[model samples]
Target: MNLMETIHLHKNDFSKTERKVYDYIVQNPTAIETATITKIAELCQVSTSGILRFCQVLGYKGYKDFRFDMLHYLHQEHVEVNSENLFDELTSKYLSVIRQFNNIDQNKLNQLIKQIKNTKNIYVIGVHYSSLPAKHLVLGLQDLGINTYFAYDYMQASHLYNTIHEDDLLIYFSIEGNQNNVSRFFDLTNASKNTYMITLNPKPKLLIENTLILPGYTLSKQSIVDLQSIVVIFVELLLNMFHNTLKED
Candidate 1:
């Protein structure tokens, strides 16, 4: 279940103080995107500790982690509409997503970026709808003069896989992270030390070695619109970082 569904499923299990916090969260999710624990407590008429406990009840490490999840959730929900006058709402949600991006561990992202940059060639694989981001990533990297290829067809993907070596990089994108094609791509890339995988599947068991796990958001039951927005933003930021590092060097 996604974060929103999980919260709703266990709503009745919350204590009175927790219920107040929960209600506040449900009502002002966007506000919570940038809200402090003190602010949340004040808004909910509870103590800061009570807010922490509320987050712990939801399986987060603490209030900060809970806020991150909430921000992701709010962004996922608000970014899909085609409203004209909703620019303010969209801007707020966009800023919230960027804030989450900013909070990503710099050391980890720098390591991933270095891995990508140092590789002789990069192959990005994604199947079905997940292929959207893979293609975007390749184009973004290419614009920065990186050697990148995006494989969408099975035959081309297979050919690309056969050519991959230790000096090359493989970046896989899978929303569910369980598709047969995605698994096969991982198996092929597993022999190469430079392989990395990104997916929305949050299950720990689904993670593979050498993967840089990024959280994915689901906007609708039938579409991965939110995940697409996330992938675009992430790839753009990564490309900018890569370019900036090159200039610095």
Candidate 2:
């Protein structure tokens, strides 16, 4: 989470004295990014130690870590997910999906952007309904100046998976999370910490920490119906943040 999100999430956890500091920071987000702890303490009418305690209450070791995340919050684009005046079930469902993606831990989104920025090579794989979303992500990465490899064929997936190094990043865009076939399962057999999966389900039998879940309706792993259009929107959302980060740089 970014500094603002962390404070908002834990606002009530702060002591009464700390709330003064909270109110100041909330009212002056941009100013807080540039202010030192002592200056913030003066502005909030609290002692320097009180400001230190306030940062610690928000899980920061000190003011420097807090300022760094606050600067990130200042530089990034603010997202507004609009889903008003909708009556249809499909629209309602899609709005819910978008809100879920919007509410994903922002720190992870920031870290995912960093992972893309730092990785030397990225191999993205998908199949069935997920092929287009995978390609969409690959193209987005390529647009951001990352050397990304795209794979939809089983042989290509296998080749990428086998040749993937510890430094290389592997991305999977799967609607069902788990594989629908033995060949695909074989291709994903070596998913590591460097692998990231964006999917509707987390039952992929891989490292859960790297899995980014989304909301969608599905009947089976190989169901005929595809809800991957929402996946495209999700990819676009991510690409927007990545593109914004690029502009910030």
How many clashing residue pairs appear in each of the predictions shown?
A: 0, 0
In candidate 1, what residue range of length 10 has the lowest lDDT sum?
Answer: 215-224
For residue 168, give model 1's deviation from the true position in Å: 1.4
lDDT of 1 by residue, 1-249 (tens): 678889888898899999998897765565564356886787789999999889888888898898778767655654355677567755655554454443343566787799877877888987777788888888888988888888886667877787777678888776666646544543543444576666654443445566554433322222435367666667777888888888988
Candidate 2, residue 71: how far the Cα is off, in Å: 39
Q: What are the lDDT figures for the candidates, one per model?
A: 0.69, 0.71
Residue pairs with backbone atoms closer than 3 Å in model 2 (clashes) = none
Off by over 4 Å in 2: 1-87, 180-190, 205-208, 218-224
Output the lDDT of residue 126, model 2: 84
Q: Tell me the tens digit of each residue's lDDT in model 2 across 1-249.
A: 666777889889989889999998786554553356776787788998888898899888988888777766655634445455333534544554454454354676677878887789888888778999999998888876889998896766776677789888888877766555624435455556778888775346443467776644331222347877878888898889888877888
TM-scores for the candidates: 0.62, 0.58
**Which candidate number maximizes lDDT?**
2
* Candidate 2 lowest-lDDT run of ten: 215-224
